[model samples]
Target: MLDELLARIEGRDFTIGIIGMGYVGLPLALTAVDRGFRVLGFDVDPDRVAQLNAGVSAIKHIPSASIAAAVSAGSFSATCDMNRLGEPDAILIAVPTPLDRHQDPDLSYVVKSTEAIARRLRAGQLVVLESTTWPGTTTEVMKPILEAGGLRAGKDFFLAFSPEREDPGNPKYSNAIIPKVVGADDPASRALACRLYDNLVAGTVPVSSSATAEAVKLTENIFRSVNIALVNELKLIYDAMGINVWEVIDAAKSKPFGYMAFYPGPGLGGHCIPIDPFYLSWKAREFEVPTRFIELAGLINNAMPQHVVHRLAEAIDKQSGRGLNGARVLIIGMAYKKNVDDMRESPSLRLTELIEARGAHTDYHDPHIPVIPRTREHAALAGRQSVALTPEVLASYDAVLIATDHDDVDWGHVVAHARLVVDTRNACAGIDTDKVVRA
Candidate 1:
């Protein structure tokens, strides 16, 4: 089975099945198809599958032309049916591993995907989980499910863990450029997974065990969460001392050796940084270990949205001679980070909730997001559409809050027309007017 799979991969004669056509899975499918391998994408969303099959991209950063070209080449397909799972020689799981309401690891999607594959399990096929999850999930949780089909892992079939590293809207990197990390309990499974990814990406880093590969992904995110929390703490301190944290970051980053700059924003956004660290923390409790640093970082990062609201209130009181009650405010960007339509863990929504609770009228304008969709937490704020950022629209608001630093917004126009602007992302840096205040 291993030799046959390797031969097909080497000859580029195999079909790659990616279960979950989300931010991670879509890019993987496109990359594999571009490399001359037939690719099949599976998703529970019938609308998403239909849209992809019709040559439309559900994600903003990925162009529809690319999807169209791949479909035209007869190498890319998407489906909601699980019966087609046996068609591919290799099935990769890139489903989401989100947190539940109690902040516990929610592996429901991963479990469902595994069960779907287990029902269709066959010999000579490889199964790789690319979800960011707890360390022992590949072996402890998925192994039992996959073996329920009466086939053994690494013998009848292959099993490995290779976490997906998809950074949306990052032009400098892609699936083909970033190096992949593959690990498995068995040597044959590790080699097969490495060979598969090495053909698609720039390189592959092999590790001793699947748990180590899972830890690698968590460690990378934990480092980011901690460093961001450090900067956010510094931002608070510097704000009290009347020093600009952005300027400090600029001067400190000039050292070029030991310092890496991570800017302070409204808060952490996107899927990985805000959520992946908690997976490790949750798993650590099994052995009675306390992740104090992760806990503190989570606390600090979680409080950033409230701090931004406080600053906005102070600024609005000083500028307009009124309290937050009935203050008309416009948020510049709604998408979590800059230049992307992904709002997975965006702080802007929480900030909006905070401001609105104080009787302030909240509206937003995002170039990428047309309307606020129903989120896991803020479903009540749905149906709110993006307001136009014309000069008249800017003048109508009491304060314009720059929650996200999207490249398309004209900060100069905002500074010139708005009564006041609270720049949380430091989007308007050099504008020296009193209307432009750094939050």
Candidate 2:
């Protein structure tokens, strides 16, 4: 079965089914189509499926023209129906693995996707999970669910875990350019996954087991979370000392070999960095171990939004006699990062909520995100439209809080017009103005 799947992958004759069709899955589909593999993208959202069917991109960085080209060539298509799951030779699950209310790992999406695939299980099919999940999820959690049909994993159907390594707005290290890490408990599954990814990406890193691959992804995110937490802590300390943490980092990173810089922002954002660390920390508790550094980092990162909001409130009080009880604040950049529309786990959402909870009216402006979409965490903020960043609009607000430092905005215009500027991202660094206060 492995040999057959490997041959089909090498020949690019087999269809690839990608579940979720969001950031990770869409890029994977594009890369697969780019490599001449026909792809069927599955998503539960009917509207998203219809839009994709018409080749309209929902993401900012992924161009509609690319989707149109893929559709025109009959290389890719999106569907809400899961009945066609059996048609694909290789099925990749790239669903969301968000944290639950208690900040524990939520594997419902992964479980549901796996169950759907299990119902349509066929012999010689390769199933690879590309979701960010706790270790043993691919084996302990998903393996039993998949094998309920009595088909063995390695012999009848191959299973593996290859966590998605997608940087949403980064073109340099795209899904195609990034080396894939493929892991399976069995050699055949591992070999098949490696063979499939080898054809799609620049390189394939074959690990020993699925848990190791999961651990690799978690470790990468934890490293980031810890570094970002350190930087965030430094930002707080330096702020208290009246020292510029950004400047300190800039000079410190000049020693190329010794240091790698991680910038401090309003808080942690994106799918992996904010959430993946918790998956490891949660899983470690099962082994009767405490992930002290990771938990501390989470606490530090989580507190950043409150800190930024306090700074904004403080700026409002300092500018006028009135505090943030009824102040009107405009947030610059609603997106999590610069030049991207992805707002999953974005600090901006928390900032807006925090600001409003303190009796302040907050509106946002982002070049990428014009309308805030409905999210699990920030559903109340949905349907909110992005306000224009005109001088009149800027002047109307009591203070302008810069959450995301998008490169497209004219920082000079912002600093010139706003009464108070609380810069969370150092966005107005180039602009010389006493009005700008680093958050």
Candidate 3:
């Protein structure tokens, strides 16, 4: 059965159905279509479906021309309907796996999407999960769900886990160029999934099992979280000794071996780095094991936002001759990282709340994000608009905090006009300024 599916995929006779047309799914769908597969994008969000159907790319990294050309060529289309699943030869799940308020792995999206796919499961159809999740999520949670349609995996159907490695705002590495990691419950299923990805991506790396594939994805993010925490902890220590961590990192990066530099910041942000490690830490608890490094990294990274607030207070008091209470504080960027609109789990929200809690008037400016959403701790400060980062506007605030270092922002203007600046992202590295404080 897997051989037959592979033959059909090789002939470009497969209809690829990509579920959840967000950052990961949209790019994958486009790449599949580019590789000559007839692709159907399914999403529960009506707005996203509408945008894709209209040939408008909502994701910043994806080119509108690429989507428009794909749609116009009749190889790609999007719908909110689940019935479209039956038309595809293979299905890919790219839904979000976020954490809940208790910091537990929220698998609601994964579970719901799995059930929807299972309802339309057909014989000889391959299923691949592209969401970043825990080790047992694919074989344990999703396998049984797919088997509910009376189709056995690796026999009547195929299932695999191929986590999406999407780096938003990166023009160098794309969906097609990044190496894909593929693993399945059985060898047949693995080969089928591997062939499918190899045709679309630059290369396909096969893993031992679905659990190993899932754990591989988690390990990558956990490595980043731990290293980032190490640097953040060192930032605090080096600050007390009047040492610049950025300069130290610059000098240390000169060594070729055994040192990959990870910078300290206000806090961790984005969907994967800040939250995905905790998913592994949560799953490790089941086997009477503890992920001490992940937990410690999360603790240190989570606390950095509040630490930035405290640093801002000191900077404002020393430079502006005022307390945090009632002082005007401006956040330069709200997006999680530089030059991207994605703000999921961005620490800037927490930084904003910490400032507001201290009775400071906080505002933000992001070309990508026009308005800030109302988070649990920042409901009262909702509906804030992005102020223009001009010289005049920069001078109006008591202090400006560089939360995100977007490319469009005028760092020179900010360095020249602002009375005091708390540089969390090292965005003001080249600019000469006396009132700059690195957080």
Candidate 4:
């Protein structure tokens, strides 16, 4: 079965089925089609599937022309139906593994996708999970569910875990340029996964087991979370001492050997850094261990949103001779990062609420995101449209908070017209105006 699958892949005769056609899956599907393999995209959202099938992109960074090219080639297709799940020679699950309300790992998406695959399990099919999850998820959580279909993972079919390293708006690294890590306990499964990825990515790294692959993903994100937390903590301390944290980072980065700079922000955002570290912390309890650094990082990073609001309040009081109540404030960016329209775990939502809770009328503008979509939390800020940033509009606000540093905004106009400007990202650097305050 394994040999036949490999032959199909090598001959470009096999079909690739990707579940959860979101950020990770869509790019992979396009890459696979470019590599001369048939690709089937699966999504539970009928609207998203329809958009994809019609050569339209739901993500801002991924252009519709790319989707149109893939659809025009006739090797790529998307559907909401699961019965076609049996037609693919290889399956990759890239669904989300978000945290639950209590900050625990929520494996509901992984479990459901696994269950769906188990029902249609067959010999000669290779299954690889590309979702970021806890170390034991692929083995302990998914293996049992898969075996319940009366097919052994290694013998009858192949199973492996390959962590997805998709950076949404990163121009330097795409799905094909980034190195892929494939791991499995079974030799055949690992070889098949590595071979498949070798064709799609620039390089392939083989690891010992699925657990290690899972740990690699967590370790990468935890490193980011901890370093960011350190910078954020230092920013608060340095602010009290009247030191510029951005200047400190510029000087410290001169060493070039011992330090890699991670800037302080309103808070941690995006799907990975904010949530992936908690997976390891939650898993550490089973071994009677303490992840002190992870816990501390979580505490410091989580506090940054409120701290930003407090800083904004202070700026407004000092610059304008009035309190936060009845003040009109405008937020510059709503997305978590620049050059993309993704808002999962965005700190801007919290900042908006904190500003509004203090009796300020808050409005936001993101060129990428025209309208704020409904989130599980922060429903009060949903359906809000982006406000145009004219010179007249900028001057009317009691304070302007730069939550995200998008490159498209006219910084000169903002620095010139705003009554009081609180810059979190050092975006107003080099302006050297009395009206601008770095938070």
TM-score of each candidate structure, all chains considered together: 0.99, 0.98, 0.97, 0.99
- Provide the global lDDT of candidate 4 against the true structure: 0.92
lDDT of 2 by residue, 1-439 (tens): 5676778888888999999988999999999999999999999999999999999999879999999999999999999889999999999999999999998898999899999999999999999999998899999999999999999998999999998899999978888989999999999999888988999998899999999999999999999999999999999999999999989988999996979999999998899999998898888988999889889999999999999988888888988978889999999988889999988888999999999999989999998999998998899999999999999999999999999999899999998989999998888777778899998
Best by lDDT: 1
Model 1 agreement with the true structure over 277-367: per-residue lDDT tens digits: 8999999999999999999999999999999999999999997779699999999888999999998889999999999999999999999
Runs of candidate 1 exceeding 4 Å displacement: none
Q: Model 3, range 262-316, lDDT digits (tens) per residue?
A: 9999899887999899888889889989888789898998899989999999999
RMSD of each: 0.8, 1.0, 1.4, 0.9
Worst 10 residues of 3 by lDDT: 373-382
Judging by lDDT, tell me the better candidate of 1 and 3. Answer: 1
Write down the lDDT that model 3 would get. 0.89
lDDT of 4 by residue, 1-439 (tens): 6777777788998899999999899999998988899999999999999999899999999999999999998989999888888889889999999998999999999999888988888887889999999888999999999899788988888899999999999988899989999999899999899889988889899999999999999999999999999999999999999999999999999996989989999998898999999999999999999999899999999999999988888888887767688899999999999878999999999999988899999989899999999998888778999999988999999999999999999888888888889999999988988998877
Model 2 segments more than 4 A misplaced? none
Local distance difference test scores for all models? 0.93, 0.92, 0.89, 0.92
